[model samples]
Every structure is written in C-alpha cells, then in structure tokens.
Target: MATSAPLLGKAAHSKASIFYGADEYLEELKKRYAHDHEIAALKNALPGEGDPNAAGVAQSNDKMLSVQKNNENRSLKTNRLFPTPNKPDPMPQNLAFLFTKITPEQMIYMWNVLTAIFCSQVLMVIGYCAALATFPDYWWTCTLCFGVPFSYIAIQNIYIDHDVMHGATFPVYEWQRFLTHPFADFFSLPWEEFVLEHNRHHASTVDLLIQGEFGWDPEEFHYALQQWAGPWSSNWYKYLLTVPFIPVIHFFGLNDTGSLFALEWWMHFPDEGAGGKCNKEFWSKWIPRRIKHNAFVLSLWACIWLLGTYPLGRPLSEGWRFMFTVSFFARIGYSAAWMFITNFTHSF
Candidate 1:
C-alpha cells in the first residue's frame, strides 16, 4: 500500500505539469493574437504609411482627380468617330471607337477568311499552270490540285457571305459591300438574290414552307417535288432519287423552275400578276444582273485559262476541259456538303 501511494503521487504530479504547460501555451497564444490585432489596426489607420503623399492626402486626392480627367479626355478623343448610345455602356473597355483600323480580336476572327482567300488564289494560279502543262496525262492529279482548293474557297466564301449578310463581321458596311460582288461571283450566287433570300429567311423564320431559305415545310417539299417531277411521282422514292441531283441542280441555278420562269414573265409583262408563280419582281431584277455577273465570271476564268495554256503551247480545248472538270467537282462537292450540313442542323 505504501509503494502504491508513491506511484499515485507521481501520476498526480505529471497531470499538474501538463495542465500548467497548457495554461502557459494558451497565454502565449493570446499575447500573439493581441499583438497581431494591434499591427492590423495600425495598418488600417495608416493605409499610405510608406507613400510620399502620406503627409499630403488632399494633394493625392487632387492628383487622382487630374488623372481621371485626363482619361476622360482621351476617351472623348477616341470616341469622336463612333458616338456611344444613351444607355449605360456594358463594355467600357472595349475598343469600339477604332473604326479605321482592325483590333486584335477582329484580326483573329478574319484570319481564316483571309488565309483561305489568299491560298485559293495561289492554288488556282498553280492549278491553271499545272493543268495546261500536264492535264491530259495527269488529269486526276490536276483535278485534285484544282478542285480541293476551289471547293475550300467556295465554302469559305459562303461563310463570309453569310457573315456579311448577317452583319457579323467588322462593322464597316462599305468594306463588306466592296467584297460582296467578288464573293458572289466566285460562289455563283448573286448578292441581291442572296440578300433577298437571307432577309426573307430572317423575317419568316417561323414559316417552314418558304423555299430554299429557312425551314423546309413537308407540304412545300411535296409541292416542289410534285412540280419538278409531276404530281403522280411525289413520293419518298422520288425524293431520294432527287437528292443525288440537288448539288448539280443548285450549281447550275436550276433548282427552282417556277422561280426562273417567273423572271421571264415579269420582264415581258411587268403589269401581269405572277399567278401561282414565284415572286416576279424579285426574279426579274435578279435574272438580268445574274446573267451579267455570271458572264463576267466565265470571261474571267476563260482569260485565266487562255493566259495559262496559250503561252505554254497547250491546247485551249484541254484548258477548257480541265477547268470545267475542276469547276464541276468543286461546285458539286461544296454544294452537297453544305446542303447535308444545313439539312442536318436545320436551324437558321
């Protein structure tokens, strides 16, 4: 019992030591926390302690105001051309005032279009030379050399055309107008017709029966099918068969017979009603313009071919044949791919 009493006394002493150490640690922590609080309070009281303006806070305030005024003046000068709206501007830092020069963001957006256009031009020139030199013997290689780049340019031009029509590009409408005609010539779609169709699509987005613009209503589909291939053969099988010829038809601008003939009707008798035909006024104006534009484009291509082949001692006939083959394949491939994507997506 005496030995057990000694061990119990040792255990009591150990517990007392632990409690005393903990109380001392807690007191140290409290002092450290109080010291940190005082330092923070001093910092908050003297925010500009290390600054030269600490003794002259009013001067500092005046300097800030002057700087703000200078910024305002600069902003006013920058925005002299493009006046902001009355509403509170959402993007104050945006470079909206730079009208003459393109910003980094605009350059990035247009990089692909510019690259595609340049590459297509170079490829066309190269293809013309190659076709003139080795067309008859290496027609397949010539077709690929010409057709792939041509197809790429056509598709890219279509994207640019659509973006221009939607006003999605740089806000300079004049620049867009300048590029519109050339792009139209290359894509084989008149700018006027494209605008009319695209605007109609935007206006009548909900109407699904309006032909070659937005949604293709089943009823209008049947009607167009019936009109093209007589009423008795307007079935699914006929539609499937017609699908294969769509790209060719589109390439030749013969997809809508009713629309084409309607132009002739208007030119001859402007006073007469369309009478179940496509819009006569639209087609009448468009047809003559398209004819002239298409002629210009054809002449341009012919000139390029002649320049390439005649000087190189190659036959003109071979040049014509090679160009025609390249044009056909490129147009068909582009139109078919575009149509498939549009049909699959089916959204405006």
Candidate 2:
C-alpha cells in the first residue's frame, strides 16, 4: 500500500546496522510496530514514532483506518493532478545530493544474489532429477508442483540483466556485463542486443505516448512482442509454434526481423557495406555472432542435462524436461500474465 514517492538517495537509508548479528537487509525498524488489535483493540496502546511501543496516549482507530485507506483517499488519482507543480528553485540542489547511496551490506549484495541465482539453478536441476528418479511414471507430478515456479529463474535473470545494463548495480559498469551475459543470455538475445533494443524503447518514450496524425502508433511494436501483431499467423498456429521452442525463439534468431538481422555487427566488427546491404560480407560478420550466441544457449542446455544425469543420478531426459518447463511452459505463463496487465494499460 505504498503511496508517497519513493525516498531517493540517503533519505532511503537506515542509519542503524544489525544490533546483534550482521543485518540481513536495509530499512529502519518500524516505530509503532503492528498496533492494530481489535478483533483489534478499539484504541491504540502503542507508542507514537520516536519511542518504544510500551505505552503512550491511546487514540481512536481513525489513524490506522485512514492510513490503510491511503491510496483510495489520495487526490493524486484525479484526471488533473490535485497539487500544483513546485515553484522553480532559485538555488538548484547539487546532483550528488541525490546520487544513490550504498552501504557495506549493500556492497556484498550482488555476490549474495549471484550466489542465490546460480545455486538455485543447481537446485532446479536437482529437483527435476529427484522428481524423475523417485516417482518414475508419476515424475511429472513433481515437475508440475515444483519445476514451474523454479523455472522463473529465467525471469529473475532478465531482472538482474536489466539492472546491470542500466549501470545501476556497480560503478564498474563495463565489467557488470560479465555478470549479465551467458546467464541473462538464457533468454537467447545477447546482452548487447537487449541493451540496444531496450534503449531504443526508452528513446521512443514520447512516440509511444503521441501517435502520428494517421491514428496509428508510429511503430507497431512498442512492448517487444511485435511478432504477434497483424496477420502473422492464426491464433492456434502461434500456440503450436510456442509449444516446442518459441520460448527460446530469440536464441534461434527466428524472432528477428529481416532488418534486425541486417543491423550493425556490433561495435568491434567490420562495418556492413554502404546503405546496409545484406550481402555476403554483412552476413559473414553477423553470422559469427549468431553462432556464438547459439553455442552459448546450446551449451547451457547441455550443462543442465549432463549435471542432471551424472551428478544428480536421474535419466538424461529429465534435464530436457526441465529445459522445456523453464522455456516453453514458463514463457506461456508469463506471457499470459503480461497480456492481462498490458491489455488495460495505456502505459504500454
């Protein structure tokens, strides 16, 4: 039920560290922690802010009730913003004052999260193996119960890759891609391609809001699923395509437009010939990158299968099922969820 604008910079930090052991996270302790009592008390016995909640002036339940209703009551929901814009500042604040703050706990968090991500990857394979070996004919029950949620690691990787791409994770931005790649490449697009694609989306922010005079968007695909638009395929045909490998389709370059395939060959490669012709030289430069990415993705799948078979002591087939769960099944679930959200949103 958060309502106020997020606190930025050091205003967001908790000055206190863990009192006993190392703090597991950031955030100031709450003041009047969990005071609601009536099936709940009719009155507050809890202290106000800046004190231990032993005893304080008791008030009616109005404050708690009002606060929990904050979003519904706020005037910010109107068609016109209720509050006027801020007056221009004669003395502009220093940008450094709002630069993100980091603490010792926050510094080690990347290693902690990366460990969790990779370790969970191993656990995911183990879970699949356990399901296959233990239950035999009923193995799919375990995958349905556990593998579905676990496969969301693909989504998690994209989120981490997003932060890394934005250079917000660490000051060593160039090296951050090392954390993103091959891992985030699970989605099949190289980190560079994702960066370029996402940057263009951001660059098109105004265009997304304002359409051309013709009443259509300037660009057909604002939300990255451009392939689904228009007379591309029948609905059931798209589902059939999705069933085998569409989740990882971007990896195979089937998701790429002809123009996208002919785009720049990245920074270090030889330039495409003048006017962006799709001649042999251009294809030669782009094909190498395509090969590298395809290898990475295939190798990742093989590692999962091998690890599942040898170490986890399950049939090698279980690894393949795990891949399908995370890719095809996971993609379907997420796409369905995302469709519900964007279907009603102008922000898309």
Per residue, candidate 1 scores C-alpha lDDT tens digits across 67-118 of: 1113333222222221123433463545555322322233223433544463
lDDT of 1: 0.40
Per-candidate Cα lDDT values, in order, are 0.40, 0.38
True-structure RMSD, every candidate: 28.8, 18.1
Best by lDDT: 1
If scored against the real structure, what TM-score would every candidate get?
A: 0.46, 0.46
In candidate 1, which residue ranges exceed 4 Å CA deviation? Answer: 1-119, 131-136, 168-189, 207-223, 226-235, 254-295, 346-348
lDDT of 1 at 59: 22
Please identify model 2 stretches exceeding 4 Å from their true place.
1-115, 169-187, 211-219, 222-291, 307-319, 332-348
For model 2 the TM-score comes to 0.46
The collision pairs in model 2 are 37-40, 37-41, 38-41
Q: Estimate, for each residue in 1-348, the C-alpha lDDT of model 2 and write its tens digit.
A: 111213111222333632211132211111112321110111122111212221243432332111111233322222222122243455356644443343424333443454456566656666666666677687668767665665466456555545443432221222233334343324344444444333333222223332211111212232334334234445546534433333343332222211122132233223234466443443644465456655765676677657546454557676665455544544443333323322223233
